[model samples]
Target: MASDHSLLAHLVPKLTRGVEDAVTDALAFILNESKPCRDALVDMVSVGDRRLASVANARTQVVASEGERLDLVAYDTAGSNRLIIESKFWAPLQDGQARRYVGHLADDGLAVLLFVAPEVRHETLWVKIARQFEHPSELKLGSTRQVGNMIVADVVNGDKRIALMGWDTLLAGLTNADSSMDANLQQLHCLALAQDEAAFAPLHAEDLNATVPRRLMAFNRLVDGVASRGAGEGWMTNKGLRAVPGRDGYLRFIGFCDTDGERLIELALYVSLKRWADLGTTPLWLRIWHKQAIDLVDLKHRLAEPGWLPAWSEPNWLWVPIELPLGVEYEDTLDSATAQVKRVRDIVVEMA
Candidate 1:
């Protein structure tokens, strides 16, 4: 588990993509500035190949001999770039990105192309990346562990190698090499750890067992029950129009109606995880765009009350919130969920 007070954890949402770029920069700095850290990384990556042994210094955002922009390059004593490290986070692999990076290393005669990413991707992401290497599709495709569960794939064409390493594997190597690493490296470790935690871990045996299905089935029952009540009130569901994304097992919020005025007024019970992840946020709310508010100042003033508060969104929107307290029992939570939705509905009714 990551620390509750990790600085990287806090800044991640605010910085958004800047954090990923900053992490790559921080890694390049640590590799160049700290010899112990750099040497340890090289030693770990080198393993049996011994080709990457000469890699001495690291640089960030180097353009390849080819036109592609490489993330990090590890240099050799002879000034030849022997290794390419691709830093990744929550982003899909670009078309031919892996193949192109490895191609850059292949030109060096002896090199390694390493991808450092969150550990959770071991099963999901690596397979997709592995497909990039196929020429009419390679017969042998899929990431494998050759260097202590770090190397994602081991491909040998003459004297070149392709490897995939988890952030955990790389950070552990740095720590194992020097227990008291530099402050920057320590911070990097914390940030990577926090990132993995936030990304959520791969499911284990407990998740695959019988206990989870019953709970999910019960939750589905709740959705069915609530949906039935909402349907009876003549709210348009638009269920067949479009499917919700990332919604788990009937977890999608019902699109109850179309319009309150010129635009639609979304008064529904939901957990807003919009990019910033309002996971533990208020359960009941009305989502209205800024344009929907004919007089923004007046609307803000009108919605200011004890049980309701209006919060603005970026680009253009406001969230009128009301807390929906829930309990473990299905009956109680069902009643609570229904009442909260009705309360939001009544508020919208008054506004109309």
Candidate 2:
């Protein structure tokens, strides 16, 4: 899967989700449904030194013994709460969140209060949470080391400890442990993949480059090419900041015909990922006005042919979405886009 693209994430994008809460819910679902998944998770934590029975259960939005609302809680076979988990994304820890969980540990229960966060936050989160076990608390920061690929921080109170792990590391371990995972695990993995891809990292010196703007300018040139082609085909072209709240800027084409006793119609091709027009399930498509003189039924069927993909909605206006080919070179892709746009326009002219 590409960055920011996941099966579950495609339906619910990362920007709209309460990332911390969503992670907690998805993981809890997988662990509760699959006992092997729970064992896999514990295997990563204990590094094969310990094992979690298949009967263990996982719950989310759990109220800890210390009255703190934890993101996840894992219960052993005997129904004892042995694993207290806190899921973090960008949100800071609540007031004394780590300290209270450490204080809640009895040191005799063999329980672990674990915090899972992004890899970028691994070192800093470990240090920040380790500070909570200082002075009066029975727990002490024992050691920080690499357990396989995970950067694990151990906060020791005799045998029991609080561990910090990265979400990426945890997901990787689980995947390696079980390759034939079910749909829940697969969906959870997709969500994690999207989160990892979307999470912005700390800025580096090499990021200050001109490549980003140069590519944006290339896209502008591509649109200009399409507009030029449309104007040459006897269609009026207009360029403007044509974007709705959820849509991107678009290039438009206007045509005048005597089909409906001399009328003018407009069509626009949006360059955004957002769904400004209803084109079935696809996020990629162009929008066209429904005020046309052509037969609606014939138009719908023809639009469903090889090149065009069209969908009907409750609205009075309909969009003609054309799928374009992505080429390596800028001019190649522009030519492909221009050809597709021309095909759609010609179809309309013939039908009208």
Candidate 3:
């Protein structure tokens, strides 16, 4: 088994030793926190390691716990910049968990909920549950039983994504021999504080805001959850799904891996829409890429629309069909695997 130190040694050395230590400590603190402790902990790690060179003249502290007030709170300011962070945990966003959370955040305008759980299923899981409340019962998304420890559902800019780690995964990463503090794991560990619907982007900065309607929020929750759950259960490909919100909040587009072996190596496009192009909404393609497959369908539907046609949206998908050469082990072609992703991106651009 590879030790964390050995794994770190194998990577490129862009991170200064001090910065690396700070980054590692920040990740460690985040993993150990009961809920997301991003605002408080990020600064702590920065300060402890002198990584806050940029914020040398800032005032930072926790929010006052004035009775009936919510969870942990903190504030940071430097010269003209000021930021606030509020931390809290939510039961898995089910049975209207997201609606309640979104409503609360919208009322406040700026709040970050630090989720405490293992592997924040931010992209796929929570969003699926929220989508359930969006459409009528007839057009709603699906659900699954909550498993493992739940993390704080961080909501920033109306973008909702899971924080990924709680105590268990954090502890496991710290103690497990195979878990290394490498760039891949570290990048994966970087908390996607919110799922920006307007741009389908992930936000990590301290100060950012977005607007999300109740139904739209619910839709995002549903879309994210089902796709993530399906992928995890192996009904679909084990890769993360993609989501794209349409213009005017009229629709959302999504896509994922579809793993049905074909007579020849191939890639497929499955699509779903808000109402008109709602075909293929079920997890039937789970055999391919899990719920991510369905999310892809949603994306295709949007791309096929009049105003939101193919060129309107970027060629947002990049997938490659991979097959092991005869007698070639998977590890033997690690470089090739990476090349395959690059090829897929190239193919997508060509198609665009």
Candidate 4:
């Protein structure tokens, strides 16, 4: 558990008060200096208000506010258009912050509220945060409503219309801008790619084959057989074979097997960390057997055997050991593996 905290801490930087201010400064500079970038932004958020493009090149005033200050406030002098941008790099909106920010723009004529973040970095976490301030009807992504002649891409807090723009979208717009401005935007784009790459590095077959041990490889093949059987029986999705390498440099699997025949069962299914998080506080046992009405006493006793272990309570990972008969040819083990998986499945059905 402590390792998990350390891993997260190492991967994600501690967001300070000034981080948003720095982002605001960079974004404001690009919007004011680059006409193409500004026009793209206006086109994305102001769907019906095409006239906003006229002010894309207008002399703009950009201000960064702290505390009561809305992240970035840009005013176009020529068109008298105001863009109130709330930029969140890592942090979620504080309590009532969204409402207060929208309220600030309520009386400001010809103004739009834009919420910008790197959605890819945080997965759907930022999307869920944005939904909290949104009306139930505006829950879908890219949802829009017309406020008079102005178009609001994401409406929140009753009539407050806001646009949620991802960093990737902003980068695409910046890419089409004049090449002369590459020096300024290149650093930002590189940083964004680095963040994305760190999150999702591709796993190669050769890399796994070379690093993984033979025992683990055998265990993975057995689990793959179990998954295949489950999918064939219409109990699981046929996602094909997946060898998820954990942060600990070990291949994480759903089924476990012991090399010796000391244990009664040859193989049993387990749960992964990602699966645990997806299931929230629900126990893996409950999630797997919830539809069945199994006796708790029998279920507990069977799971308490040397070969069967319940999921961990703290980290919530399921790791049940299964015995594989020793001194058998590696090729001959498949029949046993298949039989074990069927036995586990049968136990579920019988206990139900």
Candidate 5:
């Protein structure tokens, strides 16, 4: 038999390090050799006059500074101007990590902080982090306060600026420059896409396993209980309960719980919208257009009720909140989930 310590034990950790290294290497190559890639990155952060070639001057690395390590740091050849980037492939920014990064950069002087993550939603997480700074203010695009290209926020008495860039946006820019890129740079671009796919693949692959089925069973029990009471007589008519494939080919369920075209509700086993999208399914709110029939103010009030947990919503769907049990085996959680589903059903029925 193999010992407790084996080569495979370290494989995942090594792979994670390798992925980060590869990303950093690719970024450095782009900033050095490709002006187009550099310009795109500069545009993302809205660095007014600091072009990547002139300021960065091809000096980029995975930098260690003051007991914290940044994923990639591009500094000028003179070491005066620096662009610090924190890249994420699978993991997210840990608690207080963003705050520390912001504080550190603010004191460092004239630095632009960029955070690159797998999804755009991470941008929201970063924006919330910026709000926690000593002084946070939004840098508007024009007359209206809108976050364009990135959410640019000033921190620490306007000493440092923090910007969020999505991996997709970055990749799109890289893809556009593919025609002019050398063989090595092109290879790096492909590697970045492949890494993203690897990072996101689990969400689709794991859906048919024990966890999803367990959650679906719990959701079905809740739906059945409401139907038995005749509380869902007219609205909860679709009884076919199983995981249905979404646009991304991930197994998600609909028809298990729905409204009479007046409201939208769905229970997703996955944690975030990225995971749902990875599985090829449209979020419930995005699937339907029922805003004309539903009052947004009333919908918000209904969502505030006990047992109803808020999911994503859109202009057309108004509000779609769903009940997700803490654990399927727990009787209390099942009851809570059931009650939540019942409450939403009642609200829709009343609206109808």
Candidate 6:
């Protein structure tokens, strides 16, 4: 027969204290590195602002309602432009107390909230926080977990909560970054060389194959030579590309490219760690220049219909035109899938 003593015995006060002490140690380690934590907070704000620029008071904390109290708030004071911050460090409290803090934050309309507990690692706290948000009638806590001991979160109503971690696949991405960069430029140069009548001639197959695996591998070597470094997430621009580490081994890249001859390109690449294992097709997304001039809906149907290898069958060759940045407007014209197809169509359209 089961005994009540068995369960109650394990819940001794001494054991509970020991666990509390351990969590305290973890929290202390995280908070001790002031610079990293601050940098992480800045990154979190930048991400939120970029994603949710429509909201008013973008980076400031609101006044708490009658029975609430908050820890930190990041918001914009005037229409999402200038940023404001508010933070508080409180001693570890009971579950009810934590819930109260979160509730206070919700009432105050804080765009971002940070709760720094010196007794528990932020990751452990986040799981509890996520559940809180699920029930708005109750309370929702927000935070993040990143490589090393960084934590941040989005508390704003419409803000995108980004989960950041150390992704090994990002290193794999480096393996081909530089080579792809150079080849893209070279292909742009080659196409320019083909002026007027030459442009009317068949596009070079070699130019189309420019940013293949070999070039990507060479680029990784170049990144390796420089040693891995982070420029912080806040550096992201509507035009520049940024690579961010993600949970497990996934890496997310964001940026735009514009080549000569007035063609604009914007691309987002998601490189999975698993891609390196078999070297299979790495998931990719591209936004290219002058997209509206093409027939995307027709192309999508043809692609799904199968046995439709009209021209460039090699996935590698399809990368050139889509990847290389040209100097023109291209967003409304094409999507990622259509851009890749256009790279091949550009050749066939000319050949025909």
**Predicted model with the maximum TM-score:** 2
Model 2 lowest lDDT segment of ten = 274-283
lDDT of 5 at 330: 52
Which lDDT tens digits does candidate 5 get at residues 258-316? 45443244432222334343333322221323534445557567667554444344444
Candidate 3: C-alpha lDDT: 0.32
Q: Can you give the TM-score per candidate against the true fold?
A: 0.55, 0.63, 0.21, 0.43, 0.45, 0.24
**Model 5 ranges off by over 4 Å:** 1-17, 47-53, 58-64, 103-110, 131-147, 175-178, 182-186, 198-352
* Better model by lDDT: candidate 3 vs candidate 6: 6
lDDT against the true structure, per candidate, is: 0.62, 0.62, 0.32, 0.49, 0.51, 0.33
Candidate 2: segments with Cα more than 4 A from true spot: 1-19, 48-55, 119-127, 130-138, 161-181, 187-202, 205-210, 239-267, 273-337, 343-352
The order by descending lDDT is 1, 2, 5, 4, 6, 3
Q: Per model, state how many residue pairs clash.
A: 2, 2, 51, 0, 6, 30
TM-score of 2: 0.63
Off by over 4 Å in 1: 1-4, 106-109, 137-145, 180-182, 200-352
Question: Candidate 6 at residue 33, lDDT?
Answer: 28
Q: Which stretches of model 6 miss by more than 4 angstroms?
A: 1-41, 47-63, 71-75, 79-90, 93-110, 134-148, 152-157, 160-352
lDDT of 6: 0.33
Q: What is the Å distance of residue 194 in model 3 from its true position?
A: 23
Judging by TM-score, tell me the better candidate of 2 and 4.
Answer: 2
The sequence of per-residue lDDT tens digits that candidate 1 reaches over residues 239-333 is 54332334422334455452432223543333343422333355334455566424445555666666654444444655555454555677777
Clashes in candidate 2: how many?
Answer: 2
Ranking by TM-score: 2, 1, 5, 4, 6, 3
Error of 3 at 104 (Å): 3.8
